[model samples]
Target: MTDPGRPFPRHLRQALRTIAARVYLAVCAALLVWALVVTTTDSSDDSMAGVIPLLATAPVSLVLLVLPDHAAALVVAVVLGALVNAAVIGWCARALRR
Candidate 1:
């Protein structure tokens, strides 16, 4: 919905948010790929092996990528997502802070 032709504050803000979201999702996907690799490579016969939980995470990453049909639902999802992203990012920043 944002027009790149004009440099407006709202547009820039939205663009930044979109970029941040894509970056976050990409990081998650990368982690999922690593998990997939580990899950396949781990030869443990136990159902409760360390990599078993990785199997569960892949589906969640897939589900979150789905877009809701309704505008209100989309808005709610984005807002909630942004909040969660901010919290996690803040936490990570704190942990990694110098």
Candidate 2:
């Protein structure tokens, strides 16, 4: 069993508190909102409404293409991609802080 001291390491916590990390998170939040709006409002087959979010999300966003076509799946994919991006940003900020 692992020690139950801190749930997260010191550096990671610090990184998450940094300005760059916060900005990234904010941008991700906006993107998520945009994606949700596009997904829910645009029903046309050639809407092209998801392009911005999909491109902004990149590699993780690719999951949307492979998953079964459904609104829930799209939401899940975007949320997952945003989470992964937040983690990456936090790690990068932590590394650069050292």
Candidate 3:
């Protein structure tokens, strides 16, 4: 059982405990890291590697596109987007199992 005093609700806590949630978050992390490495090492401006990660995280971070282009912005978008996506996807998976 979940503790009532915990910040996360029971459903969310349960969702995060599942394997699906971890996989989703892992994918996001991998993409984000790949994007960063490609951007830093590749001279090509049209590299799809960097863009792909942003696209993957676009569901939640799309709004962040309006923010000025900066390292901080990208980091925030990727991190937060990954987290939100994982939580939602995990929650849905848990719900489906019920």
C-alpha lDDT values of all predictions: 0.45, 0.69, 0.78
If scored against the real structure, what TM-score would every candidate get?
Answer: 0.33, 0.69, 0.80
Clashing pairs in 1: none
Best candidate, lDDT? 3
| lDDT: worst 10-residue window of model 2 | 1-10
The whole-model C-alpha lDDT of candidate 2 against the native structure comes to: 0.69
Residue lDDT tens for model 1, 1-98: 43577666654344335544456645545644564466567687442332322233334422453666543443334344444564445445544553
Greater-TM-score candidate between 1 and 2: 2
Output the lDDT of residue 16, model 1.
39
lDDT of 3 by residue, 1-98 (tens): 55678656666767777798898778888988888898888887876675676777777787776678886788788778877887888879987998
Q: What C-alpha lDDT, on a 0 to 100 scale, does residue 53 get in candidate 3?
A: 67
Worst 10 residues of 1 by lDDT: 47-56
Q: Report model 3's TM-score to 2 decimal places.
A: 0.80
Better of 1 and 3 by lDDT: 3
- How many residue pairs clash in each candidate at the backbone level? 0, 0, 0
Candidate 3 segments exceeding 4 Å error: 1-10
Q: List the residue pairs that clash in candidate 3.
A: none
Better of 2 and 3 by TM-score: 3
